[model samples]
Target: MSYIDGFVIAVPNANREQFIRHARTFDPIFVEFGAIRVVECWGDNVPDGKLTDFRRAVQAKENESVVFSWVEWPDKATRDAGMDKVMKDPRMNAAGDLPFDGKRMIFGGFAPVVSLPD
Candidate 1:
């Protein structure tokens, strides 16, 4: 089964361009480590919820916007191996240029139950 690594983050609204540049630079490294595809989405219409929401999930501030992203891998084993390599790569340490608070980023691994026909 396909595996997915998903992420949700809060980015400073003023740093959209910088965030895109960072994503562009780093996304390929994930692919090199065995991710089949990566998708990053900038939130356009996310709304506030009384119970909980993307903003609350990440504790997004007034000046920040939400970003949802994911990386797909052929399978969990492939993802695990690739991620180990990815973690060992020195470039992962370069968080200085990140436009958002890395600590607040939410992420997880998932096994997909359904995917629409393409």
Candidate 2:
């Protein structure tokens, strides 16, 4: 089974293009390191919930939009190894170059439990 890394972040509406550019700049590095696929999604229909929601989860502000993204890996071991390289990669270490607030980013690793077309 494949391993998944899910991410959600709040990016300022004005930084949409910057965000895409940043993703384009760095996402491929994940593939080079062993990710099978990387997907970045800009939220268009996200809604607020009474108590909690994607927006609230990341403390999204009125001027920001939510982004949903993920990386697919062959397995946990590959993901772990790939991620270590990703973090150590110099490109990812550029100072003050992130398009969004890193503090507001939410992420986690998941193990898929089922699939529709197995």
Candidate 3:
């Protein structure tokens, strides 16, 4: 089974283009470092939920929109190695004043509990 890192972050609506530009700059680095896949999805269809539902999650703020994304690797070891490389890459050295609150970003590593083929 592959290893995966998942992320859910609040991106300021106004910075959407800048956010994507940053992500695009990193895509090649990730691929060269052994990432099998890099998938990024904007939160166009996120359904209302405790964490995402504005009325329920007190933390949900007005200026931010959700960004759900993930990266896939052959396994945990490869993922870790690739991430280390990614971190050391010169292009990633400075974030260049990102638009959102980094502290508020949520992320995790997940072993796929279930997946169905198309």
Candidate 4:
């Protein structure tokens, strides 16, 4: 089974293009580092919740949109090795500022329980 790294980020709506550019720039590196694929999804119909929800989890503001993303790797070992190399790469070191509020971003590694092929 593959290992997964998931992320939820709150990005200022105005910075959407910039954020996409940043992701586009880094996505290939994931594959280069042994990831099977990197998926970036912008919030389209994210709804608000009184108790809990994606928006609430990240404390999304009116001017911001939530981004759901993930990277798929063969396994945790490969992901760890790839991540190590990725962090050491010059691109990461020089990537400069993030277009989003990273402090509010949520992320975690997951073991997939079910996946139906499309």
lDDT of each: 0.93, 0.95, 0.78, 0.95
Cα lDDT tens digits, model 3, 19-89, are: 89988887778889999999977778655775456322324466667887899988899999999999999
Q: Which candidate gets the maximum TM-score versus the true structure? A: 2
- Please give me the total number of clashing residue pairs in predicted model 4: 0
Candidate 3 residue pairs that clash: none
lDDT of 1 by residue, 1-118 (tens): 7999999999999999999999898889999999999999999999999999999999999999999999999999999999999888888888576789989999999999997762
- Off-target runs (Cα >4 Å) in candidate 3 are 50-58
Q: Which ten residues in a row are the worst by lDDT in model 1?
A: 89-98
Model 2 lDDT, full chain set: 0.95
lDDT of 2 by residue, 1-118 (tens): 9999999999999999999989998899999999999999999999999989999999999999999999999999999999999999998887356889999999999999996697
- Predictions ranked by TM-score, top down? 2, 4, 1, 3
Using lDDT as the measure, the top candidate is: 2
By lDDT, rank the candidates, best first: 2, 4, 1, 3
Q: Which 10 successive residues of model 2 have the least lDDT summed?
A: 90-99
Error of 4 at 5 (Å): 0.1
Model 3 lDDT, residue 24, Cα: 89
Q: lDDT winner between 1 and 4, please give it.
A: 4
RMSD of 4: 1.2
Per-residue lDDT, model 4, residue 43, is 99
RMSD of each: 1.2, 1.0, 2.6, 1.2
